[model samples]
Target: MDLITLTGLRVRGNHGVFDFERRDGQDFVIDVELGLDLRPAAHSDDVADTVHYGELATRLAEIVAGPPVDLIETLAQRLVDACLADSRVARARVTVHKPQAPIPLTFTDVSVTMTGTR
Candidate 1:
């Protein structure tokens, strides 16, 4: 299957276990891989024949910025769901990165990844 990948989508959201985290949002980076057959779009050379990645990116940004969840896992699943909402996508893999996690130790980042299929 052909794949369309969107990476490093950044948003500010309140999604964590700590109260302060929920009160004060942090930046989240998301990545998504959408699996589908590209033949139709390739043959037609039409935007409608494929997923409108620009629009999908806007939707994903909304999801990341809209809700307060307790875990990055939840955020990942939500993104997978959103990806599958596009009928052109047969499968989706989503990753959510929490860069400002409340870990006491220094770290580059913490993240959760999830995959879903239709």
Candidate 2:
């Protein structure tokens, strides 16, 4: 299968177990990989023949910015589901990154990844 990958999609979301997290919100970075056959789009040379990435990006941003979820795992799954909404996508892998997590020690980042199939 061919792959369509989108990375470094950043959005501000209020998703955490803490109350302050819900109140203040933090930036979440998401990466998505969609597995699909690109032959139709390649042959037709039309955006309609393939998944519209710009529209997909907008949808994902809305998901991130819409509601509060406690776990990044849930967020990742939601993203995977969104990607699979396109019938052409056979599989999806999503990674949700929480950079400003409430941790005492120093850490570069915290994230969760989820994969789903149609």
Backbone Cα, N, C clashes tallied per candidate: 0, 0
TM-score of every candidate relative to the true structure: 0.97, 0.98
Residue-wise lDDT of candidate 1 within 1-118, one digit each (tens)? Answer: 9999999999999999999999999999999999999999999999999999999999999998997989889889998999999887899999999999999999999988899999
- Provide the overall lDDT of each model, using Cα atoms, as 2-decimal numbers: 0.94, 0.95
Question: What tens-digit string does per-residue lDDT give for candidate 2 at 1-118?
Answer: 9999999999999999999999999999999999999999999999999999899999999999998999989888888999999999999999999999999999999999899998
The runs of at least 3 residues in candidate 1 whose Cα sits more than 4 Å from the true structure, single-residue gaps closed, are none
Candidate 2 has its poorest 10 consecutive residues by lDDT at 72-81
**Alpha carbon lDDT of residue 50, candidate 1?**
96
